[model samples]
Structures are given as C-alpha cells and as structure tokens.
Target: MTFYFHFLSRMTLALISVGLLEACNPKSDTPQQPSGKEKTTKTEMLESGAAILQSDSPLQPMNIYLDGFHAAKDNPAHQMEAHHFCRQVNEDFAQCVLFDGNTRQANLIGIEYIISETLFETLPEEEKQYWHPHNYEILSGQLIAPGIPGIAEKELMKDKMNSYGKTWHVWNSAPFGKTGDKIPLGEAVLEWSFNQDGEALPGLVEKRDQRLGVSTNEKRNDRAELKDLAKPQSGVDALKGKFSMPAHPLPGVVDKKAAGPK
Candidate 1:
C-alpha cells in the first residue's frame, strides 16, 4: 500500500497474485463433504503450492480480521467495505490485505499498511502525504476487528488511535455485483473516510453498528480526549476535511465524485 509500490516487477506481481489467491481462501476444520468430496484448506493450499511464493513475501499466516471502508480515490464520496486480514510484521508496522465481504470465495480487493505515529513523524513531508490518521476511524467506530470482545476492541483502538495508515484499493468488486464482474479489475485508488457527522454512509454504518451492537456516536463521547492526540497528514484533509482536528492546519478538499454519480 505504499505510495511507491508501483515499481514492483512483473515477476513479483505474478507471485503476489498467485500466492494471495492460494492463501486468502481460508478453510475450516469442519468437514467440507457436502457431497463427500474433499476440499483443501487455504493453509494446505499455500503450503503445497503457494508456500514458495508466500515465503518470498513478507506477510505470512494472516491472523487478524478487520472491517473498514475504502474511499474511492477519484471519488471520496464512494465508500466501499473492505474485509481485512492483517499481519503485524514488526512492532512499528502492520499490513492488511483486504477482501470482498463474502467469506466464501472472497476475492482479493486491496491492501493497507498501518504505522505508529512516532514512525509517521520520522517520514519526509512528501512521504507523509500518503498517510492518514486513525483518530476518526477509531472514535467514529468505522474501523472494527470482528470476532473479538468489545472490551478488547476498545483497548486495541486505544493503542491505534494515533497511528497512520497508507491504503490502496485495487479491486472494484461490487457488494451486490452491481458492477457486473466477480473478477478483480480496475486501477488502484487512494482511499478516504467519512470523518464528519453528515459525511457518514447511512445504511453501511447503521448495519455495521447493529451487527456489532455498538454505537459510533457514543464512541465519540468516550474518546473525547483522544481527539487531542492525533496528527493527520496534510493530504488526508483534502478528502475528509479538517474542521476539528488535533493536527496542524493543512489544505482541504472535499471529494465530489460519488459511487453512482452526484
């Protein structure tokens, strides 16, 4: 998800595509014999074939599950749900691979890399433009790690409130297959967020809050003080705005494009 990852070789790209295809299709210990046929687990598939390719890559054994939205780069108004599988490679950084919501045969959608605020500060100004703050993602409850306890999630969010993320969405698969293809297709887009009250996705957040049994509005009250800790990059405000930010003042531009056009 780095801004400069466009330099990857065709060979490396081929390996990533194949390795991810093999690894992302997770399997269960429960028998998969509806018709008495045996289906291999994602782990097994990787070991048998993708292991070599996966070995060449940094991410291994993706362990965490998170759900968040990706704002279409050309149109920040279009927020798309991204199912994530994350691997924290080191103490300072974690990279997440995003998939379609369909856990069954979920397609590779995109990726995001998160880094601590300290690390973000060390980056040069040009590089900083690629990162966005986690303050709203946390306080607004837009970022969630599913299948975990609420208390644990709160603690986790506390730790990540000041982190910065660099994201790129490569696949444009529609939630309802409304775009017509099941294949991963399209150019990569830089994502944005609904950091303000009126900018939120109505049905999207409503259903997510219902499923998680939590209120995003209430999280705002809970993390009222956390607002003082974040420092979003300059370009982040260009898409999400910077009205009540803790970060230094920066340029701002609201994305005018929409998913289905305004």
Candidate 2:
C-alpha cells in the first residue's frame, strides 16, 4: 500500500509538470470542417456564461487522454486518428469519449468502452464480436497518451494490457487527407485495431507523429519490457491478410483462437 501511494504521488507530480509544459504548445491533429452555421456573438456569449455557471460533474471524471488510430472493421482502407478522453470506472473497466481532434473545436466522433481480460471473458460469444483486442495497439505503440511523461504513460499502458475495447464511430465528419462528409452521416461503424505492421494506411501514422511530436517507433522500443505481460488476445487476426501490402505480425501479439492448435 505504501508503494502504491508513493507511485501515485510521483504520477500526479509528473502529470502536473507535463501539463504545464504542454500548455504552452497544444497540438490538435485532425482538421474538422463540419457543416454548421457560424455561431453568432449572442450564442457565443451564452456558451461562455454556461461554462462559468454549469457544473459538469459527469465530464469531470474524464481525466485520462489518449491518442490512437482505428480502422473500420469491414473496410481496412477507411481509417482515422482517434483521440480518447477516458474515465476509469474501476480497476477493470473504463469508458471513453472519442474525438477527431484534441482541441476545443474538435468534433465528437464516437465512444469506446474498455474492459480487462477477466471482465471480457464473462461476455457472451455473440457480444464478443463487437470488442477488439488491445494487445497490438499497446505493443505496437500505436496508442499513446500525448502530454504525459514517459514513466506515467508506461504505467498507464501497463494497466491496460490484455484489455478489450468496443468502439463505435458515429461520425464521418473527418478522415485522413480527405474532405469528409459535411456532417455526420450514415450508420455507426465498428472500429478495429491494427494487428500487424503495414496494416495502417500509408502516411497516416506519419502525419499524426509529425503533428504531435512523438514517435511510434521510439514508443514501441520503450515499451519492450511490457511485452512479457501480453497474452494471446481475441480479434488480433480479425483483419489478417486484409491490407494490400503483406502484413507482418507484431512481436508478442498473438491470437490463440486464430492460431488453432499450436
């Protein structure tokens, strides 16, 4: 218990320091141009007043921020950068609000609910199809907490090992290098993880890295120690052989069910 509290203290301090430094230069990756009439001065004033008077208790708990990429389950070609503002509900469960960008003008795109492997095992087989495995996301360093210190980020990833996430993207308002729908359109689509290298769209991850001043390769190298914590996860092979290029398996990521008998 002492060690736990000590670690928490260090994490808190690191977050505070990093937050202060990053405030000077905030980064927002996606550029969204949702079709909407410009807000009038009167409307802006009302919003400013509401911000001061309203108690956003529900949103207050959403403290953790993460950036990752997601591809449409049925179509690997459709991919986008996902910014997650998550609230940890418990030791084994979390819920996140997804956005296309990380700034005030960003569009709300979807939601994702995450659960530990233990909690996931309790779900029905039919329901399991909706959840995607997270091992590859973490091990490959495709998921990141942008403004946090390296130690804090690693600890955060360590806690999420072997977890599963069920994500539903409701808006097609912003996609990589293209003018998306003027407004949200069509049915909500299920998003999946990139299980292998060469699966993500070319130049997709690069643009995000350039904008955020982070490196996926560096992150992947730093997280090498966490690989030992990995277990064969479900959905790791769901998009196998789907990419145009020959996909290569990420080290330490495996899908036992997909592998069959040894």
Task: Report RMSD (Å) for each prediction in the order shown.
Answer: 11.5, 3.1
RMSD of 1: 11.5
Q: Estimated TM-score per prediction?
A: 0.64, 0.90
Q: What lDDT does candidate 1 reach at residue 46? A: 69
Model 2 lDDT, residue 96, Cα: 94
Query: CA lDDT of 257 in candidate 2?
Result: 92
TM-score of 2: 0.90
Q: Return the clash pairs for model 2, or none.
A: none
TM-score of 1: 0.64
Q: Write the per-residue lDDT of candidate 2 for residues 57-165, one digit (tens) a residue.
A: 6876675778999999998788999999877777788889999888778889999999999999999999999999998899888898877668868888888889999
Misplaced by over 4 Å in model 1 are 1-60, 175-180, 211-214, 231-233, 240-262
Candidate 1, poorest ten consecutive residues by summed lDDT? 27-36
Report, for all candidates in order, the number of backbone clashes: 0, 0
Candidate achieving the largest TM-score: 2
lDDT of 1 by residue, 73-177 (tens): 556556667777776666678888877662545667778898987798799978876776666677666787665445555666677766778888776664321
